[model samples]
Target: MSLSDDGGYGGDGHRGPETGQTRTRLPGGDGDLYGSGRRPRAGMSSRNLVTIVGVIVLLLAAIAFANRDGSGNSESGGDSPKDTGPGAARPTAPTGTKPVTGKNGQIASGFAKTEQGAQSAAANYAVALVSANILKPGERHAIVQQVFAPAKVDDMQSRLDAAYSTAFLKKLGLDAKGDAAPGMTYVSRTVPVGTKLVKLQGDTADLEVWCTGLFGTAGAKSTTPVTSDWFTMRLQLKWAGGDWKVDGFSQQDGPAPVNGDDKTSGADQIAKAVEQYGGFTYAR
Candidate 1:
């Protein structure tokens, strides 16, 4: 019953000396033992000095060239070069390939039995778990059934019901049924920023989804004005009945970025946008 945030969530370098001065012996024979009478040695020969300098210059040039940004010459033009190195950031844009084409009720289902499918399932389940739709008893039950394994649905439903109880709803200025007062819109939406596979094997995957969410009430007189929050959702999913389903999940505070000072929108404007806009079935 862990929901994403939105309130409901749950050394040193050595230096070399100069090459050059000629050593001269001191009159005292002690010079050989102590080497205290050494005189200035002749400076390095012009040819040797030039060669050494040339080698140094080449080394510097080579270093500069090696360190130059390789991104500028990318064949992709100005597009960021594809990073094939280990630990590279994932591409932000969709691959244009849908993660899953099947649906169980309104929930995306039948994800491929692959790592990508596991990620896709985790992301979509995260969205459903934190969505405003889950506020309603009917939709919550449907979400619980569709996103969790058959064995977990009943227990999950009871747990979620308690988590979203009348007291919790009241705190956010919502009725026992989880409805906002007239003229107010309750907001609870999760937008996954990215997903990472922590561990994947056989039929189980441990994933972490970084997300930003909007929650609270939107209305001129609303006490709980809609606001944004950042959080990470850790989902443990298992392949079941030919699809991936949430076996368990938990929420944690962010990996959040600093908030920007953007102009605030009016309640009506926020409500209008939410109504007009549609959410996506996220894919990895």
Candidate 2:
């Protein structure tokens, strides 16, 4: 996210990108993999060729044997644990813990002192940070104060106010108050796909939140039709007065997938769906 809106492969040879060590083919550091560019004997003997082939055959047989699966008749009768590879990612699932029944004017509050709570806080904070309500100066101030730490409220409010000015809102077909025109719905909603806790210690925690959202206007005569965006937010949270509050925020464009070929709903249908289906609290 150029501080705005936008930021993988398996362990196979084909990858999007890679990090850490690479297989060094240089001659000096690791051993030379190409046998120091030595030429083969011009008059190679048949015995040597046969011996090399035999070694290769044995090596291939050993590899095949090592990769074979069990026959399923062993006494233990259990399969081996899977190695998910170096690029395996953690799966998201419900922790089965209920969220606290608390709210600070639609924003969540009173999170527990746990990693799950930090994740939940990160998700909600990201949602509020990008909502259409941020277009309104007063609402934006309130949101910043509620989701951020007390020490950061003033700076955050000022920064957001500058980003969502009167002119910016106008460009998006919104008024000074961030409201759509009559019979129109200005859509902005962030739905977090998953959250990963990066670090947690004492009164501070860091998290990564992957999200998708709908943004634009919903009306038959609207210029900006609702479109979806995918992004990842990195949040630094601090435990304050028995709750997790946002301390730092940054975003980047997605690990997005190819768009699907789905039927586009009418503006009226889209508006009605948004109104009827309320957003979730996102406890993980």
**Which candidate gets the maximum lDDT versus the true structure?**
1
TM-score of each: 0.68, 0.68
Candidate 2, residue 26: Cα displacement in angstroms equals 56
lDDT (Cα, 0-100) at 44 in candidate 1: 31
Candidate 1 lands at a TM-score of: 0.68
State the displacement of the C-alpha of residue 146, model 2, in Å, after optimal TM-score superposition.
0.8
Q: Which ten residues in a row have the lowest lDDT in candidate 1?
A: 11-20
Best model number under TM-score: 1
Off by over 4 Å in 1: 1-8, 11-88, 92-97
In the range 1-284, model 2's lDDT, one tens digit per residue, is 11221111011110001111111112224322212222232443454334333322332232222213311111111232234521124676766776655999989888888877888888888787767676667887788789888887776566556555666556556788878899888777788888877667789776778877765567766544455656667777889878998766555557676655444556677789989998777787
The alpha-carbon RMSD values of the candidates against the true structure, listed in the order shown, are 26.6, 22.4
lDDT by residue for model 1 (36-154), tens:
32332444346534433332233223222222321111111122323552113577576666689787776788798776788889888888876777767788888888988777777
How many backbone collisions does model 2 have? 6
Residue pairs in candidate 2 whose N, alpha carbon or C atoms collide under 3 angstroms: 1-6, 1-252, 6-252, 6-253, 7-252, 7-253
